[model samples]
Target chain A: MSAVLRVQDLSVAFHTRGGVVRALDRVGFSLGAGETMALVGESGSGKSVTAYAIMGLLEAAGRVTGGQAWLGETDLLAADLSRIRGRRVAMIFQNPRAALNPIRAVGAQIADVLRRHGGASRFNAGARAIEALRAVGIPDPARRAKAYPFELSGGMCQRVMIAIAVAANPELLIADEPTTGLDVTTQAVVMDLIQAMAARTGMATILITHDLALAAERAQRIAVMHAGHVVEEADTATLLAQPRHPYTARLIAATPTAAGSLDDLQSVPGGLPDLRRDDTPPCRYAARCERRLASCDGALSVRALAPGHQVACTNPLEAAA
Target chain B: MRAILLRLVGAIPTLFGVVLVTFLLTRVLPGDTATYFAGPTASPESIAQIRTSLGLDRPLPEQFWRYLVDLGHGDLGMSLTTGQPVKTELVNRLPASAELTLCGLLLAIGIAVPLGVLAAVRQGSLIDHACRVVATAGVSLPVFFTGLLLVYVFYFLLGWSPAPLGRLDAFASAPKQHTGFYLVDTLWAGDFETFRAAAAQIILPAGTLALFALAPIARITRASMLAVLGSEFIRTARASGLSGPTVVLTYALRNALLPVVTVLGMVFSFLLGANVLVEKVFAWPGIGSYAIEALIASDYAPVQGFVLTMAVLYVLLNLAIDLVNRAIDPRARRGA
Candidate 1:
């Protein structure tokens, strides 16, 4: 299947008084129509940065040094920000309460996006906004539409945000830790809503998260990132069964699941390398790898281990024959 | 709506406290109005008669009681200096002060709000630097000095402004007092020439006051806009495919305006206080100058009346601000 969205060699840096922090380095991934790809990593691992960079929503200090994010025929990075942001691609932020405009009514906020990008007529925008809200499983959507963000619960606010992100039914949706601060029960519901929406619309989705088990459960494909580099990418089952990169193995071992008890989990040692350093290594996880080889110091590249399975390391684990 | 009512009811005690304080403070001042009116050279017998007639011979409690009764009846008593009723003086002069204050406020808001938004949008750029310089200069200079400097430049150096005198040219006849505001009164009289003269005369004092008012308005706008611009909602707005202008004005500015409106209310009260110096410099016949004159002459009634009026105005102004704030921010309306 052709990619609905293809991001290739995306590199970003933040310029600050201390130094230029290399945020993302040659990060590349692609998602086919209606496919859900989870980009999993620890906090500050450039997962959110990659999402923001793709949506052209990076903060003032951040700059896309080199990249091409193609959504259909248009390169999103080079495209006019307004053209592709909501019409073609939409984002669901982590903190819905903060992301939703505080002073505006939730209904008005949804209607704004619908009118602007969904081609909803001004006269019918309110009805369409309520319809969008109801689509996200919000009960009494008409009454709730008149409420402000502060007036709603966290879960409801997130639902409003989801309604806004999916209002235009864009071809691609990027959810940046959409369930980060929510309770477990609400997390399940929100995730279910996103999955259901993506399936219903046949829209591509890039779900960025730190939960390995969640990625395994919800995403069709998984990409493991460590210190701004995609360490491994494969089908979710293949990545979970036999993670080639050492970091990916550690992550899988660390994630506690219904089948695996807490005692079975093993935490990875060492912290992420500071990206601000002048001599930052190409293989960011080489220092933490137990199977480190002297050749790991050289330029690392994504080597295909099998069809549709790639790992970026000089010495990747070989599958047992 | 209930919150507004509560605030209004709550202001009763605050106004009472102001009344008590102003009454006590003016009475305790070094010179007594009776003695000042009697003159330093008057004989003791004549002084005693003057004091008796002015009711200074009455007990302090009884005097205060009578003062309260008169105040309740809307009689602010007679000004010992001007011999006019203090209430009448305030009524006539209040419009002048309101006109100047309103004009200055309009100028300040018109210039500062846009300038602040631009400064915040292009933070760290040359325009931001320029705004910073302007705000700093506005805050650094005293109002009197700024007024004088403006007079020296526009009136003396450039010859663009009217003379630094009262509301109209010295020889111009006073227009019929309909609204008591010269601008309104002249327009009411259908005398465009007098209106032009009044408008020109106000430009210098109002402009001077506007500079004083501009600094805080601009700074608050910049800081508030900067904060809102950095908020997640602004990102959401931008991500929603809004054009740059819509994102700034509709989303950022609307949210930013809450805090700026709060500061604007405070600035309005501050400008009213600052008007004393501006009035003195420009020789504009406003309540501020009247209060200062009464203050210097130790006229008890006008000073008391002026303070009471200002206190009431402050309470009313705060109420207006609360209403405006609630109108703009529904969260505030809901007390959320």
Candidate 2:
């Protein structure tokens, strides 16, 4: 499959009262048309930053220092994204209730997005909005659309959020911890709905979350992020069978699975390195990697073990594992 | 409608409290109402007769009972100074104060809301600094001082405005009293000349009140807008690819206005209190100055009636605010 979205050498920094914090450094990834890629990372791993930077939704304090994010032929980082943001690329945020406007009706909110990007007229936007709500499996879309976000349950709000994100049938949907605040069952349902929508529209998805099990179950490719770097990327099965990067292995070890007991889970050791420091190492995860070598201190780069699998570490777990 | 009815019913006790307090406070004043009504050189027998005739010689408790009974019958008693019923006195002067207060509030909103929104949108910029200076100047300057300064500049120095006199000049006849507001009444009577004179006479005082009212409205709007702009939904709005204006105005401003509506209610109450000084400076025949004059003369009825009227107007204003809030925010409706 051809690449529908490509991000290369993306860097982001936030100016704060204390100092400048470099959040992302040279992070890069690509998604094919209709592909589902999961960006799995711990807190402060810059997964959401990458998504926001690509969407041009970063806060005023944050700046994209270096990067190129290409959506098809257009360079998203350099291009005027106002026209393309909701038309070609859309986002679903965490805490669906907060993501939706509190004062507006759910249907009117959807109609706002549709009218802005979908060429829906004022006369038909209401009906089309209800139709969009119905498409996301919201029961009684006509009545529920008139309801406000506070009136809906968490799961129902997530469905409304999905309805809004896909209102224009954008080519790329970025789901940033979309199911974070939802219940476990609702999480599964929401993820399934997102998958179904992506499949129906042939839309690519980049799911940003730290839940490795959900990523494994829903995504075709998994990219493991450490600190601010994309430390590993591979097909889900291959990555799980043999996680070449030590950080990826530890992340998998940490995740709770259906078959794994509480004792079977092994937590990833050490916290993320402080990116605010001036003398930080080139390899952000080297401090925590048990396999760290002297060579890890040198310039770090991604080396492919197979056609689809890449790892950034100097030392890797044996393939025989 | 039911909510409004409930709210009105709930306001009864508050109104009663205000009436009781006003009655007790007026009773504590140094001079007696009957004594004030009777001339100073009047014979002692006539003063005593006047006290008895006016029911002031009765025991305090019986007097309060009679007062409450009279209030129940919507009889506010008679104004000692005007020798007219306090109800009629209030009815006659209320529209003038109402007109001035409403005009001031409208002007303040027209200028302050947009300035606040602009300051919040370009926060820390030159326009924001300018807004801060304007708000600071507005608040720091006293209302009467601003009123006098405007009179000095517009009326005395420039001759651009009519004298800082009452609502209409001596030359202009009173417009046919449709609404009691000179501007409205003049228009209703198709009396454009009197309307122009009324508008000119009002501009300085109204502008003074507007300047004082603008500070709080602008500050609250800017603060509320800043908070709403930072919320997650605002980012969602931007990510939706709506135009910048729509995102700021429709999404952010709508949410921001909830706090502003609340502040507007508070500012309206403050402006009502601020009106007495403004009315005195302009010589406008409004109920505020009427209350002050009655208080000085120890005319118990008009003072008590003025406080009661103000309390009732405040209650009605709060009800209007609640309705407006319900319209703007569905969550408020749910809470109601």
Candidate 3:
């Protein structure tokens, strides 16, 4: 399938009093029709930053220094705020509790999206809002539409957020930590709802999260990020069975699998390199790599491990290749 | 509901605060009504007789007790200047003040809310910046100045003066004065021309008070709205395909109103208290000017009545604010 949303070399940066923080450095990824791609990373690893850039929801302080988010023919980064805000791209945020308006009813929030993009009148818009709520498997959608955000559970609120993001039927949906704050069961249900909706609508989704196991199960492809770079990208099965980059191997080993004990599950050592200094290298994961060769310091570039899988490093760990 | 009750209970202190300050402040303002009324050179015996009869010779506590007891019976005290009962004076003047305050508050809210909302929606933009300048000017300039400016515009420039200065027209002789308000009285006069003229005269004063009120309320409203707009829910609402107004009205402005409601109560009480100056500026015979004349004449009844009424007004305004707060935030009701 053609790429529903193609993000090419999108790098976001923050200029501060201290120095420029290269939050996202030449990070590239894409989402195709009905496919789920998880951008997994730790906090401050440019996971949420990349999602914000994709959805065009970056705060005033941050800027998309170099990038383009394509929604069909429209370039979202270049689109006017009013045009992009309601119609083309939609986003679901972390902390479902804070993501919804407390004063407004959930159904009304969904209907709001529909009304703005669907050209529905007040009556029809509300009907469609209820329909969107029902689509996300919310029971008694009409009655539930009148209920305030606080009245509902966290799971319900996140579902409401999903319903809102999907209501306009945008080709691209950026689910930014859609289940971060939710309980385990609620997380499963939310992920299922997101996947089901994406599949039904044939919309591309970039699910930014920190949960590797969940990403493994839900994502068609997983883009493992380290510091501010996409260190490895591949189909989930291939990446899991034969991980290439050292960071990706460390991440898989770090996953809390029932097959491994605490001693076997080792975390990657050392902290991420600070990108403030001018000497910061293209290979951000080089500091944490076990097999750091002399040639590793050269301009690290992407080398294809497979037809569709790419790894960004001068030296790959022996086990993954 | 419990919070509302608690708020009502708290109102006692507010009422006491109003009466105490009004009473004490008027007393200590370096002017004595007894001396003002008796004149610079009067017989000591006549002064003593006047003091005793006026209950001034009684102990301070006894005097305060008498004032409260009379107040409970709805007797504010008589205006020494007019020989009218203080209750009668309040009853007579209340409608005019109420009319002016009500209109002024409505006018203030009408202007302030929209202006504040517009400024908030487009913060740092031209409309927002211009309104900021206007609000600063509105708040910085005194009510007296605003009233004078309005008079200059309406009376001097436009030649559209209100029926003299008083609330009622001198010619109405007021066929029916049940409402105690001039507009109501004029309506009862069955004379639209007189009513229209009375309303016209009332408008300038009311409008002046409103503009003075508008400044702070606008500034507060804009600040509150800016904060709400910055909240995550507003961002969520926008991302949900909601229009600017929908997100603002449903998500942003409704939440912002919590602070605005509080200020509204204060503004209501403030406008009532400030009406005295406003009435004087407009040359209208409202409670403010009445209190001054009564204070000078040692008309203890009317002054006490005015202070007591002002106290009650302040307390009641707080109560209204509590109820409004409970109504807007569902969580507050649960907490209560």
Candidate 4:
């Protein structure tokens, strides 16, 4: 399948009072048409930063230093995103209620996006917004459209957010921890809604999440990140079954499976290296890797063990099962 | 609408409290109303008869009962100094003060809201710095001092204003009374010359009040806008590809308006109080001067009537603000 988004060597730096914090460093990933890829990591892992940079939604203090985010023919990092942001690529953020305008009606919010990118006229935007709401499986979407974000449940708000995101039928969608504050059942429902919408539109999805189990269940491919680097990338089955990188193995061990008890979970030891330090090592996970070698101090490179599995480490873990 | 009606009904007790406080406080003031009205060389018998005729011989509670009854009948008694009914005196003078306060407040909002929003949007820019300076200067300087400075610059030095006079210039006469707001009445009377003269006469005092009112309004707007700008919804709005102006003006500004409007209500009441000094400086014939003149002679009726009018106006203003707030914010409609 042809790729819809190909990000290369994306680096983002935030200028703070202390020093420049390299939030994302040479992070790269790609998604093919209709493909669902999850960028999974812990907090401060640059997953959301990469998403924001691609969407041109980074704060004033942060800027893309070096990167090329090619959305087909256009370089997203360089293009005027005002026209492309909601039209060609859209996003649904964490905290669905906070992500929506509190004072505006949910339907008006949807209509705003529809008119902006969906090519709906003023008179037709309201009706088209109701249709968009109905597409997300909202009950009585007509009345629900007039309801404010504060009036809706968290799951319903997420669904409204999804409706707004997919209003233009964009070619790419970035969901940045879209189910963070929702309940477990609502999480599944919202994730299912996103998957169903992506399938209907054939839009490429970049799901940024910290839940490894969620990534395993929903994403076809997964990219594991630590600090600011994409440390490993592979098909979800291969990565989960025979994780090559030690960090990926530790991540899998950290997850609570159906059969695994509380005592069976193993956490990855040590914290992420300070990205602000100028003398920090190239391989951010090497300091925490038990399999770290002297060579790990040198330049880190991606080593492909199988046809579709790649890991960035000097000493890799052998395939399990 | 029900909310407005409720608020109106609720305001009655507050107005009554104001009336009660004003009545008692005026009674406690130094110098005697009967003595002052009776004159210096009056005989003891004449003074006694005068006191009796003026209802001063009645006990406090009875006097209060009579006052309340008169108030229920829309009578504010009579001003000893002017020999006119206090209600009629207040009715004639209130419009000038109302016109001045309204003009000042409108001017302050028109300038400060945009200035504050711009300062927040282009934070740390020269415009922001200028707004800070303007706000600080407005807040620090006294209203009377600013009034005098304006009169000095525009009337004495620059020759742009009429003499720091009352409502009209020597050449222009008062227009027919429709709204009692000279700007409205002159326009209604098709007297462009008087309108221009009225505008000129009002410019200094209103500007003085506007300068004072704008400081807090601009500061609050800037603070509120800064907060709204940092919220997640703003980033969401930007991600949704709404135009920069739409996101800032419509989304950001509307969210910022609640606090700004709240501050506006406070600033308005403050402006009314500040109007007294401004009115005194400009020699304007408004209720502020009327009350101050009555207070000096210890003529209790006009002073009491003045406080009552202000209290009623404040209650009504608060109701107006509540309605405006409801219109601006739906959350407020739910009483949230």
Candidate 5:
């Protein structure tokens, strides 16, 4: 399958009160047709930055330093903000409440999206919007269409947002922490909804979240990010069965999986390296890695541990992986 | 609906309480109403007769009863100064004030809301800054000064003085005074020339008062809009990829309107009382200035009646704002 979306050598930085903060360092990944890829990382690890970079939702301050997010033929990273947002790319945010307009009826919001993307005419958009709402499993969608964002529960609002996102049915979907704040059951249902929708639509999806377990369950491939760099990428099964990179191992060990016993769990030590000082270039996970070696000083190169599995580390974990 | 009814029920005590205070305060002024009207040298027997007839000699409770009874009967006492029926003057005076207040409110809303929206949308830009400056000017300057400035420019320089006062020249010149409001009366008369002059006359004074009021309304609107724009739900609206205008109108303005509506209600009520200065400066016979004339003569009848009417109107205007707010936002109607 030709890559439905490709983000090559992407870097993003912000000029905050503190000198330049490298939010997203040279990172790269791709999602093939109907493929689900996860970019998992802790807060401030540039997980959202990467997702935003792909969605072109970066705020006025953050800038894409070097990137070419090729969505088939169109380079998303280089496209105008409005064009990328309203046409080819779509996103689902973490906070469903913050992702919708409080005043408008949910149906109106869906119709607006449909109209903007030319998915439906102004007159036809209303019916299409109701259809989209129904597609996302909202019951009595026609009646609910008149309800404002505040009238709907968080879960319903999230579904309404999904309806609007799927209205355009763009080739790519970036779900950044889309289920983070949701209750576990709600999270499962929302994720299942997205995955089910993606299966039916054959659209590529980039799920940016901190939950390794969730990524493992939802995504075909998982990309572990640490300090704004892609540390490891592999099929979910292979990566889970045999993880490479100390960061990836630490991540897998830290996740408290319900299916596994507590003894299998371990916590990552220290924290992400500060991305400021001129001396800030290195394996960001080096200080946190128990398997760190003296040679882990300069550029960490991508070494394939298995076919189609690339881990950026000086010494790739030779066990299981 | 019950909450609103409850609120309306609460407003009664408040209205009565405010009216009672105004009634007592007007009586408490150093000079006596009897003396002001009767002249200081009147005979003792005559004074007693006047007091008795005016119901002033009655005990405080008895007087309050009489006042309430008379009020219920739509009978404010006859004015000792004019000797004309108090209700007649009140009936005549109220329409002019009502017209001016109505026009001023329309003017304020028309200018304030759009400018406020512009400021919020273009925050930190020149338009926002400029609107801020204008708002500050509107709020700080006294209505009298604003009215005077307008009169000077429109009357002397630009030649747009408001229609002459008390005369309702347009209405009198037109065939009849069937509808008390000169504009309405004039328009009803089917004499376009008089109607045009009557409207033009109102414009200068009304605009001046509106300018004085515009700042606060604009500031409240802009601040509320800015706050709404940054809210989590607004971000959600954007994420849905609803185009910019829809996002702003649907998400931002609806939430912002509630507070702005509250401010507009208060401003409308305040303007009812404050238009006195504008009326005086423009030599327009609005209730504000008419009340001052009643104040000078110590005409207890019109004063009491006007105060009661105004208090009632203030509550009603606030209620109107609430209804409008509820109409615009159902979530608010649900108290969410």
Candidate 6:
């Protein structure tokens, strides 16, 4: 099946008082219709930036220097933000409470999207909002519809955010750290709700998160980003079982689940290079890589290791093959 | 509704405190009503007689008790300067002050809110810079100087304004008092000529007060709008694909209005206090000038009455603001 969304060579830079910081560089990924992909990374690894760029919701200082984000037939990067956003695509933000309009009723917020994009009539929007809330497993959704964001708990707020996101039933959904602040149980429930909805609607989803375990558990394919670059992309089980790039192997090693004991958890050596410098290397992880080779220089490009598996490093770990 | 009623009931003690403090503070001034009314050259015996007749010779507690009794009976006491009942003088003067203040407030909100929202939406643009300059100049200039400058320009230089001397021209007869507001009263009387005269006379003072009121309203609006626009919900609103205007006006502006409403209430009260200078400059017969005149003459009853009136007005204004705030912000309603 043709991919529902395909983002290619995306580069984003933030202009600040100090200098220009490249927030995202040459990030590329694709998700087929009804497929689930997780963009997993550490903080400041451009996972969230990539999502925002595709949604056309970057801050004033951040600009997309080069990119082509194709959502079906429309180029999301070039489309009018109003034309694509909330209609063809939607986003569920990290902090659900902060992501909602505090003063407005949560139901009204959902109804707003329905009316704005779903073409729901004003008279029936209220009922449809309650229906949306119910679909998210919110108890007493009719009564809860009248409640504002402040009145709800954190988990409930996330559910409301989910409800609002799926109200219009867009073709693609970008969930950026949707479960970061939620408890484990609530996180599972929220993720389950999203998965169920995506399954029912056949919508493609890009789950942006730093939780490697959660990504490995939920995603069909995983894209590991580091220092503003996607270093590895492969099937979730294959990537975790046989991580190709040294960075990906280190990430899997650092993750608590894959380690045999607490002592076995190995932190990645060194740090991500500062993107503000003019002499920054093309492969940001090169300086931190223990398996670096002399040829790991100049512009790095993605090379296929196996079908549906790619690594951006010249000296990727080839032990499994 | 219950919250509003509770707030109103709570205002009683606050008004009483104001009355007690004002009464004591006026008594502590260097001169008493007796000496001022008796004149500087009056005989000692005549001064004593005036003091006794005016009930100033009574003990402080007895005076306070009698004042409260008279207040309960709706008698604000007799003004020593004008020989009229304080309530009657206030009734005659309050509408002018209200008209001027209301006009100033409406004009300020009209100009400031839109300008503030525009500045915030187009932050760092030329319009934002211009708004900043306007806000700075408004807060920097004293109200009297601004009033005088306006009068000089509009009346003296441009010859576009009427004489800045009270609510109407001296030669024109006053309109019959129905509502006591000259603008409304003239319009009620179907005398467009008197309405035109009243409108022309009020322009400079109201304009001056509007400038004073605009700064805080605009600044608060801009700051609040900037904050609300930067919030995560604004991104949510934008991501929802609501049109830009809908997001700015419905989502951003509505949320921004809470602080703006608060500042508007404060600015209204501040303008009432600031009205003294504006009234004096234009020779308008408003309560601010009346209070000042009574203050200069050490006329105890009118001064006390003016303070009491102001205190009551403030309490009521606060209640109104609380209601408006509750209407706009669900959180405020829940907290209350």
Over all chains combined, what TM-score does candidate 6 have? Answer: 0.96
Predicted candidate 3 versus true structure: per-residue lDDT over B219-294, tens digit per residue = 8899999998888887787666576677778788899999999889878877887788888888787777888777
What level of docking quality does candidate 3 show?
medium
With a 3 Å backbone cut-off (N, CA, C), the pairs that clash in candidate 4 are none
Worst 10 residues of 2 chain A by lDDT: A312-321
**Chain A TM-score of each candidate structure, as shown:** 0.98, 0.98, 0.95, 0.98, 0.96, 0.98
Residue-by-residue lDDT tens digits, candidate 1, B1-336: 677789889999998898889988988988877778989899889989999998889988898889999989999999988889999999989998999999999999999999999999999999899889989998999999999999999999999998989899976788998777888889998999999999999999999999999999999999999999999999888887877888899899999999999998899999999998999999989999999999999998999999999999999999998889989999777773
Error of 1 at A78 (Å): 1.5
**Residue A164 C-alpha lDDT in model 4:** 89
lDDT score for residue A124 of model 6: 96
For residues A173-226, what per-residue lDDT tens digits would candidate 4 score against the true structure? Answer: 999999999999999999999999999999999999999999999999999999
Across B84-147, the per-residue lDDT of candidate 6 in tens digits comes to 9999999989999999998899889999999999999999999899889989999999999999
Q: State the C-alpha lDDT per candidate.
A: 0.91, 0.92, 0.80, 0.92, 0.80, 0.91
lDDT of 2 by residue, A1-321 (tens): 579999888999999887888999998889999999999999999999999999999988999999888999999987899998888999999999998999999999999999998899999999999999999999999999899999999899989988988988899999999999899999999999999999999999999999999899999999999888999999999999999999998998899888879899899989998888887899999888898899989999988999889988888888964
Looking at candidate 5 chain A, the ten consecutive residues that score lowest on lDDT are: A79-88
lDDT pick, better of 4 and 6: 4
- List pairs with backbone clashes in candidate 1: none
Residue-level error in angstroms, candidate 1, position B237:
1.2
List TM-score per model, in order: 0.97, 0.98, 0.87, 0.98, 0.92, 0.96
True-structure lDDT of candidate 6: 0.91
Clashing pairs in 6: none
Q: Which runs of model 5 end up more than 4 angstroms from their true locations?
A: A81-87, A276-278, A291-297, A300-307, A319-321, B1-7, B160-191
- Output the lDDT of residue B149, model 6: 97
Better candidate by DockQ, 1 or 6: 6
